[model samples]
Target: MIGKARGQEGREGAAGVLPAHGMTHYPAAFYHMTHLFYQSGPPLYAGNICTGRSGTAIISLMGETQGRVLLVTSGKELLMEMTPSMSGRGMELVCVPTLKYAADRLAAGDCPTLVVDFGWLPPSERGALLELHKQFPKTQLFTLESVASMAPAVPSPLRRLSWPLPMGFADQVRVIAKPVIILADQVLFSTGAVQNAFQQAGVQAESLEFGAELPDFIRRQSEARAASARTQKPKKGWSLLGGDEEPEQEAAAAIGNLVVAQFTGSAAQAGALDAAVRAVAPEAVCYLVSGVDTQRYAMQSLKEGQPVALPREQAGRIAGIMAESAEGGETRLKQRERERILLLDNFKPALTALSQALIGHGYEVTSSMDGAEALRLTTKGSFHLAVVGTAITMAELSGAELAQKMRERDPDMRIIFMVDQYPLKAALQGVSQVVELGLDDAILKPVEASRLIFSVEKALERRFLLLENARLLKETQEQKNQLELVNGFQKKFFATVAHDVKSPLTAILGYAEVLTGKLKAMPSEGRYAANIQTSAKTLNVLISDLVDLAAMESGKLRVEIGTLNLLAVMNDVYERVKIAATNRKLNMTLEVPPVLPPLAGDDARVGQVVQNLCTNAIQYTKEGGKITIKAELKPDRVEVSVIDTGIGISKEDLPRVWERFFQTKEAMGMRKAGFGLGLKIAREIVQRHGGEMGIESELGVGSRFFFHIPLNGPPPTEGAAGAAPAAAPKPAPPSGLPPAPRPPQQPQPPPQNPHLPPQPPQRK
Candidate 1:
């Protein structure tokens, strides 16, 4: 039954017989007997090969006949079974699971030429294959689907009379040859979907199911094969694939205090290195000497203080050498030495005198009689300090205004304010103005030389102190930044994970909601759906709380300040939470005076504060408990309180109740579900709105939490803790309970009124 199918013979066979195995029980006879090879010798090919694709196996069998077989399939067990069978038939077999692995081997310029692609792969693997194909265009792509629809034309030399194929081979196994009709035995299944996919991918597939079609398919796969060998220029020499023999040379100028020296054919390089050290810094000067004489010369110079020397033995100790040098001690100071000083005054003589005084102190002074000229000079140069007169006769800017401009230019700049005379009462005004302008000091005019010198020296000293402090502060800030980076990463990770988890939970909740309505007639299913919705909501709440906490801690929370109607805010909260309160059989009430004034805060955030407090009350309270929300217009502020008869806080626990994640014993006892962040977030919001939030409670009684915001309403300004326009902060009830009873000072001796019998127990 085994047969060889050549050009004419394959055509007749394609039209002839069908096997009785339903094309499933493929005999091994066709694998050996089918002679369908091209005459171009060993050709390049690549594609996915797996059990599901019949053409891939056929292509693999063809490759085995002429050369080695490289199987690309993830099914290792399947390959293991096929390996021994293929080996017994005297063929070589190699298997790679992923397209990437196979492509990599091919790109190394040394791998098998044939690749058989079978079925759909992941996009990434397919992309790797496509990229490799671009690199080696001679490499052929053979698909099981593309080959099954054609009757392959087996060349004369490639055709055999009779060869026994290994077990489990079938010529009837179907393949999807794109847009071609071979005989029923060789026809492909599911050609439409595969062809459409190939079209979308811009792949031009050649059919190989017919004998007449073999030449064209081979032509496409071998388009560049003949040209590739003729075009390749031979490599010139043996390349060092590891690396270059010589290392890369670093730029000589980039070498800091440390210096590198190389001795060229001589033992005496010390003289040359000494000259080099003089060109840079004397305090540094490390020598890397191969000869003992050069090292001795360097050590002798160091001993005589002519120059410093670094040891060749200590060549590895770069950090230690840097530490020993003065260069390390004054790195920051050297950076700050290019200091400029600005002097401004209408009196040119005084200005010149003061300028000379500072210049004598080694300061570079830029002088100007006109305030406008001084500002222009500052613009032209960077200044470390400024000396400004109290008054100047300039068209553009006044002296104080000029100082303000300088401060704006560099907030760290030291400024000294000078005046003509220090009037007794007026001196305070001048001093306040000087402080407000951020000037270092204000000296009266006709200033004595000693006084001016003293003041200037003090200012410079203060400036140096500030600079040193700033340097230290920068180091501290770097450490702080590292910690903040870690915290930021953690926060972002939590936020991202929470967000990702929330998406699926949202879908689940949505589905459950839909199911709840649909399953109303089935109580059991409806109950399950309700549970799902409730669980999803609880998870959503936890995620929301975590996100809000992160936002608050990272300073990302924002509130828009405006005049808010307290009554409306309270009423809105009541309406939102009344149902929950009623469900617990708790009495909830809202009290707002009709003539209350508007408070200053973000309306939405203020509403959140109220809602949180009310919700907390509802959660904590028992049946028949009462909750009251009250808002009133105080003399300078609007006060809002949420009072509840609940499991009251203990004395020790009262202070810590606002701390995040600090759940109380009562809450834990009730097994309430919460993140314990509401009060903390509420307090932060209130503080951000320029308000004070507090609490009062007595154990076993009740708790009242309240916040007060200014009615005149000056919310905190951006980047500053500007106080609200309210009166000075007055201490509210200092404790959560009424003030403890004071001990009688002297016991009052039964009221030094022993005579009046305590006034008959106080007349009514």
Candidate 2:
């Protein structure tokens, strides 16, 4: 057994083999030593040793290599062995699998040399080691080998390194290190093969034992490489990764070119952070990142960028630093819609007063006495408006020049010049130039705070109006799209209703008609059946009319015109209305010229117009009232009128009489339930036939309703002859029974039935 080394509990292992100039190679048994060990005596103090339990001793050994290290290994075994003991020390070790990886690291200024275990490299990776030698002949390559002769230059016995250390040891390496010497306890035969390959590839190999002299050489080499790298230009930016605990204050301070505050909160909070920063520190640049769901309102409120999540304390410190910079430096935050304003003047009192006034008026205000400083700040920041004192005259830059510079940075930035008595002319001239560049206004000095505030308010108001207009325009377009969607839905729903409802309606009508015929012998039951059949028929007609109105509104209603006898159409309507007139005990007459000319119209629709008007007269006119229906041929048109002594329309109700489903107060009061579509359909039919229809009425008196159509059939061409003319004034009605009493007035809209297709409500 060998004697124990100093401060160690275990004895040194026996030296197994050595060359004339190589260090002693210890036996493999010594690798598991329980205590620190070294050479038995001072024989060049160069040999393999094991420090038991104390990895720090190994750290001392690793310190002997260059500061920046590119560690090349066939496997992680060697790098893992060195990491734990080497961490928290000054050495920077970068591990790689091949020499090409080492070259890449070197090219990126990661390290200058490859501390490679050539013996551990498999055959496939050996080619890159040899190729790298050709490309970078000066790169130092190390090999762990037992035989000294394998590497001719400074060949030394090497001990294989396979010690396992604590975790996170590799993380402590702060920067890259190069020209490293990897310690190992046992060398392989492949080490000799690697050295032979390198020599064949025209690359010299050097080997040296780790001892006192190597540390100085490595330090000097690292310094030289660092100096050279400093002289060379950098290719890109660099960032350092800090540990997971509290962020290193020194590291954060070093990267102060940008400081981001990421607010993780509601979108409202995030969106307001910009204005908040402006209000709190007008020079602070703020960006917000919200935690709100992206699927709802889009995450566009925060305009700058995404927010960063960091420890609260660390974020707070960063915020403090940014606020401090905003206060102490010439930099300011970018301006926004809330009207951030920058005020500059050499006059301290005036500047202070103006700033306070602006602040009182709810403006974010930043002020500086130096014009050049203002210019410098403009480059780093933004302002909605800049108020410059023309009286200011700085040696470096004048107020006008500062204004010009700010405008150059932001063309839309508003500038307001303040002039004293003497410089008013010059200020005005400068104002004109900047006006072309976007100056807003100028105010004379000795101006009232109220006036200045008004000017500021006006400027901000105008800008806000523009922004509001743009926002409203977007909203308007959205509403338009919504309306179009509603219209499409209505069209589809009406079509479906028309198709689905008509079948059931036809069955009801058919059944009621059969019941009416079967119950005719029983007078009371027959009356009920007749009522049901009448109601069903009425419903069928209403449905048909609704479909027609929908088609007419959508521009799909077809109109077929032909010559038709005016008297015949009127006679058909009178025949339909005569029973109602007799039931109501009213006098009704149909006046038609014997030789009346044929009118140009759809005959059924023309008859429908006449029938609806006469029915309305019979329904409204009470007992003993008179209704007169007349058709007369004019020069170019035929005019028909239905005159009734009935409860007439009020002035307010007359205008909307033609609207679909619009019923007057008197009409609804008569206890008459109707769709209110008759008059509307009548007018639509007449108008489609290129004719005109209208009603003349007075409340508590009588009424006259009329329609006129072309007598020569459909117009042959544009501006064809015999176009329908306005109707002639009707003669007074013959003396008859009293007019129907009008109901008390109460304005109300037309009753609506959801089953019917939707129409715009008529104004009462």
Candidate 3:
């Protein structure tokens, strides 16, 4: 329960309010459950005091006050050493040996917001995360690593339930580190043919070289562990934060003093890695050597203040001089402040607000009137972030090209496309271009400043962090076979959790129907049957989510990714969602693409998302007047959107929609037919393929659901061999993974509250 107190300083020293909902209380015994480990190298948070070589992570916990912390350490020794300040907070640490163990503990009815140090997750344990989600629905899970490395962006039953624990200025840093994904791969060969191709391109790459060595000093101390039984422990039980024991200061001190890091691959990769390291710490030097005597020279040289050695025989006539890679011609950061933006006609507020926001956030801002000015400054000045005023543009620089140019110049600037509207299909296409052009971020127009700021910072910080952290990768030549094996195991394990959660739901629904029929005969079981059916619906939704995720990963969809018109896609979506619209008595409107461009993607999944959004709009509208689908064509992409004059979503639930099994505040107490998977599956489909999907809502008025996709996309290809095939007949040979479109598992209904008002039902 230790967190920012009322009137306490938050980020930027702003005061934060204390628990308004009355924070959950933890039993005193919970603190007695584990040994303590506190670590201080670079202050985990500022003002705590940091020594040694490490970075900073200002915000510590997830947004909400985490009720309890579950630490995954190897043993008490690690615990005592890592947490030296245990006595100050009177905090209790519970050590679960493995990710699975901690996941199981959380699922087995423990309800503490957990802080999992994923560093201990064995390189082999891929599915532990999915397994954990199945059992613990209420527990909000945060990975020490970013969500992407969770592998496949697979939808768990509790998709909305996860947040990240970032240690530094990482956006996903609240969770996974991208380097972990690179390291998670098993060993590959040094002279792999794949690596030679990269080398030919003048891109540094290597499958393997020599195993990196531990620092000489730490090496000598750990020799005894090698001499003793080398226990290949189960990933489930190796929690370093073991059972409750007294904090050990000596161990904490040792953990603090010694630094453990790894480097792998070949000289070229090492050299590139050196570039990465210097990106953060300009003066630091990097030495790459094999496991033999050469590496010893590098180590001894460090200790004795001598120069690093280069072994000519092994390194193949070494290039003597190597320093940080050049940052090229880019010098000063780009600034845009207080200027007229002429591109956008209808979204003037969005443009003006963005400029004001950038200035407020301490950036000098200027508005580009059109694509020409945007292109001019994109190349001329060193701008940190760009807000494209309109979705459509005409001039020398296309919106996507402008973003690309910024990347080419600095490779660190942030670019956001201010889109007005879009179709689900077209939005997915735009997202790919953002990734391809290496732009930082994008936002749909008419966004809140809070939301806009989030994208801006995320985009700006992500570029630099990716550059700096790329070097921190363990850099092994991970074997393809091993990686596949791990991914497969995860795929199967998630399949199992999804199935297991579904079983009880199926049984309950079955029994409820039986009882409902019997109630017609006895009249007594009707109430119980209703309750059972309600619970069954919720569980069913969870199952669907799992199944949808599995399908996407296995690429079981019928259509391959391709470029298609947003207006055309919108027409298709309207046809599908018409029934839902009719039942709700809502009118539909269209504001469409004029000379629409083709969006690159699978048409079917995008259609499914549109249908889901439309259905949601229909259900929420009060005998609704109108719902509109708008498609706006940008320079290099299209925006597809569903606009509805329906009851708007609460701010609390806006973020929850894209999450698995999440329900709106109004729907929480009803026997809703669908589980919370509609939005969850929609988002997974959008973001899984590297697009962004979100909703903007104002309570009681209306909601605008929109997304952007690129006009260019790689052609789709074959589905994975042996995976479930899509329902459609086999198409011509595919060029890429044929991702599936179905929800993996059915989502469950939200937990109903008795005091809430009854939900109004639309006509069937």
Candidate 4:
């Protein structure tokens, strides 16, 4: 059974057995026990254990110690087995089972060391350890893992140690041949452990408690080494003919090879150190030896493939990693240097400065102060990307126009625009236009080297992505087939629905007419029946139009040509639409030459076209508007026009009126009842008769729609009319008769008897 010590008596008894070490003061029992567990291994003592008010077993030792150390693990037995070995050594061990408890212990006070057992931790919970370390960087951190063999040779900071420590642990943790510098607290350096560790690892190590002097020290060392190397160079051998002169040696690199830094809980200090290292050695491999937390110095380490933070225990791997990184960094630099960039700016100073900055970053840069010269350069040599100023001064081609021409030359090249900040709205609009035009990106000037580099990288990345997508789409034949199938199915579905509704709609119209007649004596009921009949007729026309649209889309629309009597077709249409016009209080008229030449066309379709025009005019026209259907004889054909005093179409909208499903804004506002397919269908019919259709209109001023059909009928090539054309030559209009004059006003025609069948109008 484990014994417990509590209160002052327990604290006194535990303190009596502790040995003194010249370090920070801490509770005696914990200080002794932690050292015993770390140094002597396993359970050696258990009698000094004490329980706190919170029910956790804490061993309190009062003595001078290095600092308090927190051990977090899930293995309760390990703590129980090791509790008895708490007598000497200046360290404290507080064991907790989870990270939450570890955080709680940390919140209590200053703890300078923490050890985590990874065997019991989950991968998902590993990030919490980094957070804990970030919160408490003063802690000397370590980890114990059971599966160290499975870790990568160049392990990340979180996976630095293994349980059942690997062979030659001290040797494995050595820094090999590279020099190491340790920046830590003064007390840490005084302990001698950090220095001894580096010494035994066979590396020259220096310690600096203050971070400010590191950069100057490095710079001085570099200068001295450079001076020494220069002095050591052999003098060129002389011959009378200069044949024995030695080849000049290659210059030493300006950047250092590798640097390892230990962060002492100061972000500004760490950043300064990083900047200094970069100034002296841009390609140097920097290793940040952080505790369990790495978030502290993340921002300070900006360059890719430069600094990777590692656990303090992995200091030995730095030298090996440095050699590998150096080789890999050179390869990457070469690849970057191969990327050719074209810079175009009419402003000479800006162009020169930007060119130099890009070239310094290892890009091959070609710059031009004139837009035309820049274009010529692009033709002469290939470039991976172009950086252009939006305002190109003293040039015939603007930046935007130049970009378009360049794209025409090579579609794959990536482009980025540099825009000025003045004229704020225009700059914003320019940025938007860059995206709209599918150019890569836009950067607001004055451009910083860092920002420009970042933009260039991202644009190139997008270019590659688009190219890959285009290649994939080309190879996906199955997707194309599926798209075509979907379109075909949609057309078929619309046609099927239209056909199914036609039968029911015919019955509805017939029934409504019957109801109207039966309920005539009842005025209200008769009105309802009439309304139903009217609605049914509108629906029938819409359905017929939909059916015709489907047929035309599928290329199945056909015209059965026969002898067409212009007078009879016009009169039939006039009678059919006269009731609708009268209901709306609109005046309608039809005028045709008294003697007209016989034409070859489909009579029913022709009447349908004329009726569609009359219906549209009625729908848009205000009350008491006028509509005229006029036909005149021409030398080769007859011209028929539908003139309306309804709302007129704007000139811009007139061209689009013939397009299917397109409605003018005014037309839609006045009547929301159409699919806008009537005009499209009517025009298609006219074209199928080997004729052309056109419209003239003015907003709010009425419109005139017309078509011309040959008198000899459609040409022989137009699939021969059902009958021969009448042998009569074209007849002239009545002498001294004005064309399309309105008749004198007279009494309104009486409504047709509801029970009487309607009769077709006779030809003039």
Clashes of each: 18, 13, 87, 15
Candidate 3 lDDT, tens digit per residue, 248-328?
433333221111133344333444444454343332223232222332223333333222333112221111111010121
Residue 268 local lDDT, model 1: 22
- Comparing 1 with 3 on TM-score, the higher-scoring candidate is 1
Model 1's TM-score against the true structure: 0.31
User: Model 1 lDDT vs. the true structure?
Assistant: 0.53
What are the lDDT scores of the predictions, listed in order? Answer: 0.53, 0.54, 0.46, 0.61
Instruction: Candidate 2: list runs displaced more than 4 Å.
Output: 1-347, 356-430, 433-439, 444-454, 460-482, 507-515, 522-525, 622-624, 712-764
Which regions in candidate 4 have their CA more than 4 angstroms from the true location? Answer: 1-133, 136-358, 361-489, 716-764
- On lDDT, the stronger of 2 and 3 is 2
Q: What ordering of candidates by TM-score runs from best to worst?
A: 2, 4, 1, 3
**In candidate 1, what are the lDDT values of residues 84-104, reduced to their tens digit?**
344334344444445654554
Candidate 4 lDDT at 225 equals: 59
Evaluation by TM-score, superior candidate among 2 and 4:
2
TM-score quality measure for candidate 2 = 0.43
Could you tell me every candidate's TM-score relative to the true structure? 0.31, 0.43, 0.26, 0.42
Q: Which candidate comes out best when scored by lDDT?
A: 4
